[model samples]
Target: MFEKRELAREHLKFENNLFAQRLVPWPLLNAPFEGSWCVIAPGTASTPHAHHEYEIFIAMKGKARLETGGKSIDFNVGDIVHFTPGTDHSIVNDGTEPFEMYSVWWDAPMAENFLKKHVATEN
Candidate 1:
């Protein structure tokens, strides 16, 4: 079983100058992980937030800065970042172009358990 979604048809939610679209866990897909697509306008940033789920962000376009753990990291197109559960983070777009990224998140415990089982089987 697989699913497909067209980006052009997806509705984007707006906050300030930031645009976001929920891609996974939608009505048709009851996935354990959640996913989203975001575009941050120049000089804008996503709200700093944290949750119980581990998160991965894959930069799709432009340059930006990732603020987390009291430090700022330079992020560019094609860069990928990971944040452990409950780590506060946000993406700041200081460049003239929109910072585009895809985000995927899932429960930390669930992921750990899955990895443990797979590793145990391999061992």
Candidate 2:
């Protein structure tokens, strides 16, 4: 079986953070391994929060300041970052260009709960 989904850029909001096309749905993937394409618009920053699951962040384009545990680091194209459970993190656009990324949440339920609870909020 095969499934294809056409994804477009949209706004993703969690609490007070704003994300563009963040936490995209991956219906094709099996459970316990769901993922989504994440995007951060220019001059935008995500809400600093922590998750109960492990997440892998892949940078597709542009650069941004990745903040974790009150520490900020610059990330650019082809960069990969990983966040474990209880690690507070957020991404902020440090340049004038859009930052694109694809992230995967190993814990499907945790990711779904967060995305469903706090997506579609406008900045």
Candidate 3:
């Protein structure tokens, strides 16, 4: 058996060039498994931020220069990267193509607490 959940594309909110869509938003999942798809237009970059989640990225198309915790790594399609908690990270698309990736994250204690509150409200 399989769990089939279909969300229409129109429900996703993609605003601008450095767009991030919570492809499977935590709010929608109402669980700790959070994931998203980011599309960075050529010559744009993502804002550096840190969080409690262990972040993992899988490059699906184009290329990008990733800066994380004072180091830089250039990644192309099929590359993957993982950033630990509190690692300041950002992605830059220097080439003339859209850089897209799928990212997912989950926190242990923090995620547990957040989900507790989230599920409580939904109940």
Candidate 4:
């Protein structure tokens, strides 16, 4: 039923961070139906970035402040946020302890474009 896949952690690229490492994706969870968890160190911040996928995040531990398309939201533990393709977004750990969150993202069109743009030269 599935056409392509990438193991989260195996193929993870550094999303972004100023003070700590975050988002260790499991390659298997890179698909639209899959998901991953990222741990953010306190006082850390992620720079603005955009993806060609639909994404969602749920704060699992401490507070997480997120910005998207010039809008900001302070998410408490258990709060979930959704984002669409082409939207500029960023994340930050704004609580005392380390922050953990679940991320679910997928984009079929982007994957096709990526393959056409990069994999054509993989051989």
Candidate 5:
């Protein structure tokens, strides 16, 4: 079976106070699909953004809310949400504990550029 540990680790610049650790890739699978395990720390939110790719989210643990188009939908463990491409969305942890979820992307570019201009950061 295909496993995530076998896949290379790549970090994505998703949003402010948030980032994603990509675990699985489409190239590893027999078919075209990408899988990832995202860990959202407490007091943080996956920034509002959109991509030109079909996306789906499966809540694995903790409490969180999915925000899209200025509306919020509370999702818990075992909840699944499927939306089309370019649908502006983000996730926030409204609870005390960290939120974990499994995300997948299909038939689209793996990495997306959220920042247009260079912002000098103090390292």
Candidate 6:
């Protein structure tokens, strides 16, 4: 089965004062990974948080600073960032316009098992 949805503002949900929309593994689609589109208003920051899943962020628009591992890394459109499991991180939108990004995450154990199975088959 295939599930498709338009990434529009009407689909966004307000969470923690940020606008976000869950895409993959959504109600109509079941997958191993979870994905979301997030937008942070200018001069705002997402809450610092950590989880047990590995995550990657793809900057889509505007500019922001990623605060993680006690370091602040600036990122802009076309930039990609990865976070290891349990790494506390947050995005701060310091630019004049809203910051947009896509986030994809999966459990560490699930990824490890997938690699084991796929790598062995390839070998």
lDDT of each: 0.83, 0.72, 0.79, 0.68, 0.71, 0.86
Best by TM-score: 6
TM-score of 1: 0.78
Candidate 2 achieves a global lDDT of: 0.72
TM-score of each: 0.78, 0.71, 0.73, 0.63, 0.70, 0.81
Backbone clash total for model 3 is: 0
Tens-digit per-residue lDDT, 32-106, candidate 5: 456677777787888678877788999988999999978999989999998798899889997889898888877
**Over 4 Å off, model 4:** 1-15, 18-31, 109-123
Candidate rank order under lDDT: 6, 1, 3, 2, 5, 4
Native-to-model Cα distance after best TM-score fit, residue 27 in candidate 2, in Å: 5.3
1-123 per-residue lDDT for model 3 (tens digits): 245555444454564446766745344445565777788889988878888789899999999999887888998899999888898988889999989888888888757867788878879
By TM-score, how accurate is candidate 6? 0.81
Please provide the root mean square deviation of candidate 3 (C-alpha atoms, Å).
Answer: 4.3
Per-structure clash totals for the candidates:
0, 1, 0, 11, 0, 0
RMSD of 1: 5.2
Highest lDDT: give the candidate number.
6
The regions of model 6 sitting more than 4 angstroms off are: 24-28, 108-123
- Pull out the clashing pairs in model 1: none
Error of 2 at 117 (Å): 24
